[model samples]
Each structure stands twice: as structure tokens, then as C-alpha cells.
Target: MFTYDTTRATAEAFAVAAPIDAPVSRGRRRIRELCADCVRIVLADLLLVLYRLRTVGLENIPTEGGALVIHNHVSVVDWLFVFVACPRVPRFVMHYRDYDRPGFRWLFDAFGVIPIAPKKEDPELLARADRAIDEALAAGDLVVICPEGTMTPDGELSPFREGATRIARRCNVPVVPVVLVGLWGSIFSRKNGSPLSSLPRAGRAQVSIVAGPPVAPGRVSTAYLVEMVTLLRGRHR
Candidate 1:
């Protein structure tokens, strides 16, 4: 193991050899992120056409600063719609099993998806996910979480877990509530109790994404979020 002096000396040597200009690095990173966003939007356009998607109150998603975006989980493609709708590229907090899937791991890693499991499954994994979320929020990054923990089996909304409220309070960030309408009977939903076995709708599904104003951290709660989302969802499934 290296001592403090040795580590400092090594760092100094590297810095001297290749001094990094902070402003230039930041500018380059911003440009790269913008380019990536452009690519994401282009890909999302295809889905938009396929789904005949519409969005409402999208301005509620902050362009800057950290916040928790909590939404109901009704289908497998819910995250994709949220990902495409947000102005800022948000980091998704997804299930560890999904993140660790054999073929899709590369895609999740490329987008920096945060994989989380229950403490009962693995305490260390849960701890790491919590830390990653905190760090991301501290860095003013948007973090999206599906508080239902899993997709609803039926077309109705499921009771939300307390994780979203807890994170919002701890990080002192607002909670942005979003609702996905018209995904309940889609192929991605658990309509037949299995997404894989379900078939796509006959025509392009008219999907709507409704976003509400950010709720203050002090007022955040599992019930309140569920209510807000339900109201936004209206009579739609």
C-alpha cells in the first residue's frame, strides 16, 4: 500500500505531466452530453411514432438541479417513455435482476443505470445503490425511480413504496410525479400475467405522459405521490 506522501507525489507527477484545463474539459463533456441527447431523441422519435405518444406538463421536469422522478410502474416500457420525455438525461434506478440480464447489461451500463435490490436479497447491494443515488443527487443529476417496485399485474395503480419519499427528504430535493396513461393493455404490460407472451395492440397505442409540478420535500409521501399520479392518469388505464 502506498503512503500519503507517495500518493500525493504520484498525483502531482501525473498532474504536471498532463495538466487538465477544467473549463475545457467541462465544455467538452457538455458537448458530448448534448450529442448523446440528440442521438437519444432521434431514437425516441421512432417510438413516438409507433406509440402515437403525447406529453403534458413536461416543463415540470427541471432542466437543472437534482430531483426524484417517481412514477407508477404499469409496463416494461414505462421507463423508456420517461427517459425520452425528460429534458435532462435522467439516471434510472432499476431492479438489479434487470440490470444484470445477460444481453442488456451493456445498454444499462452505457446509460449508467443504478441497479438496486432489497436489503433482504443483499444488504451490500442495497447499500451501494443507496450511495450511488445519493451521490447522483448531490451532483444535481435527475434520478428516476419506479416506487411500485414492479409492474402492476392489472390495469390499476399499485400501492407505492416509501423509497421515493425517503430519498426526496434525505436529499432535500423535490419529487416530480409523472403518470403513464394507456400502457396497461400494451404488450409491455402484464395484461396476460406475462409481458413476453402478450401480443401488441392492433394499432398504434395512444400513450400520454402527464407530469405534475414538483412536490416539496417536506410534503412528499407515498400516498400523496400515488394520488397525484392517479389524478394525472384520470380515466385512462
Candidate 2:
């Protein structure tokens, strides 16, 4: 087991960083209260039926705050591990393009996922998303993001877009880097010319999630973020 205390730490990895101070929510919530709770229950049941999530270092996740969680984008269900690691309720910054898919749309809307236009050239969309992030942080909620922008075509890692640092700086919130490993080899792992229907009849996965220390804003850098991401990725190797 690995232990981490990241709720308090100075930022040093980047040339531009700031202190994020999103407060923790004072109210109470249950995962069932989100948009489509019955579906979330179904997802939980599916996790048991199809995937055996071997989660570790959950304690590394900060329990409370306006924290920005940057994670690797692998499978479509990355949020599942986060829901298990983060507090009962966590918000995701998802892509607008995914909102229309029936199966995924149900889940996304049910969880109150905030959507961002997939087109990076859309300044208005970006601005809207930035404000939504600020509002969510100000309300003391956890925001889960995949800095790589989209799901990887292959399981290999991709470049993390620069938006994470911006969100951290804009909200002055600590960025927690999370790595989801082993899922690519699990039931939902992608295959050549195979669609979702081709997934195994039943499968088990060795899923793991490790959170790095919460990094302060203002002093964050691209290298530091990569280093943190690399550290999280190391757990699976």
C-alpha cells in the first residue's frame, strides 16, 4: 500500500502557479441523488458482473475541497474508478460530443457531467467551460478531468492538453493527478475492428487508481504535471 498527504503542499514544478482554495461543500449528498441514480446503480452492478476493480491508494484522494483531478483518459468508464476513489459524489468535465450517445448520455447526464465542446477552436465554449469550472470549484465540488483531451486511439498514452493548468490557475485549486491502469487489458479493453458488442461475455479487470499530492497553483509547470502523471503511471508497471 502507498500513502500520500497532498492536501497541503507548495507548488514548485511550474513557472506559473497559484494557490487554489476551493472550499469543501457543507451539505450532504449521496451518489443516488445524481441525475440518473438507477443507472449508476446499474453501473455499480455491472462493475461486479463484468469487471473486478482492484483499487489501491484510494486514501491518496483528497476527501474534501475544490480540487481539480487530472487523470489519464483510457476507457470510456474512467469515471467509475474516480467515483470509487473520490467522495461519493464527483463531477466530471466531459466532451459535448459524447452527450448524444444513448447509453453514455444517460450516464453522463445522470451524473451532472459538465460538457465542453470537443472543438478546441471554439473560444466561446472554452470560456463557458472555464466559468463552469470556477463555479463548481467555488461550490466546493471535485472536478475530474482528462488533460489528454480525448480517449486514446490506442492504449498508449497521449499528450495532455494544456487546459488542466489553466483550470488550476483559474480556480486556484490544487490539481490531483490520477492514473487508471490495467483496464485496457480488462473486459472493456479495445480490440481491432471490435465494437462494444464484441466485449467478453464476462471479464475481470485489475483496476488501480493512485493520486499524487495536491499541487498548488501559480508555480505549476508542464514538466511538473508530466512528472506527477508519470508517478501515477508507475504504480501499474
Estimated TM-score for each candidate: 0.84, 0.75
For residues 62-162, write the lDDT of model 2, one tens digit per residue.
67878888888777678776764564367788777765576666555445577787454666776666777788777777888888886766777788778
lDDT of 1: 0.76
Candidate 1 deviates by what RMSD?
Answer: 10.5
Number of backbone collisions per candidate: 0, 11
- Clashes counted in candidate 2 amount to 11
**Candidate with best TM-score:** 1
Model 1, range 1-237, lDDT digits (tens) per residue? Answer: 001111212211211111111122344334434443654655587776688877888899999999999888988888888887888678799998988889876556545578899989989888878888887788788999998898898887788888898999999999999999988888788988688686677889888888899999999888888888888888444
lDDT, candidate 2, at 114? 73
C-alpha positional error of residue 2 in candidate 2 after TM-score superposition, expressed in Å? 18
- What TM-score would you give candidate 1 relative to the actual structure? 0.84
Worst-scoring 10-residue span by lDDT in model 1: 13-22
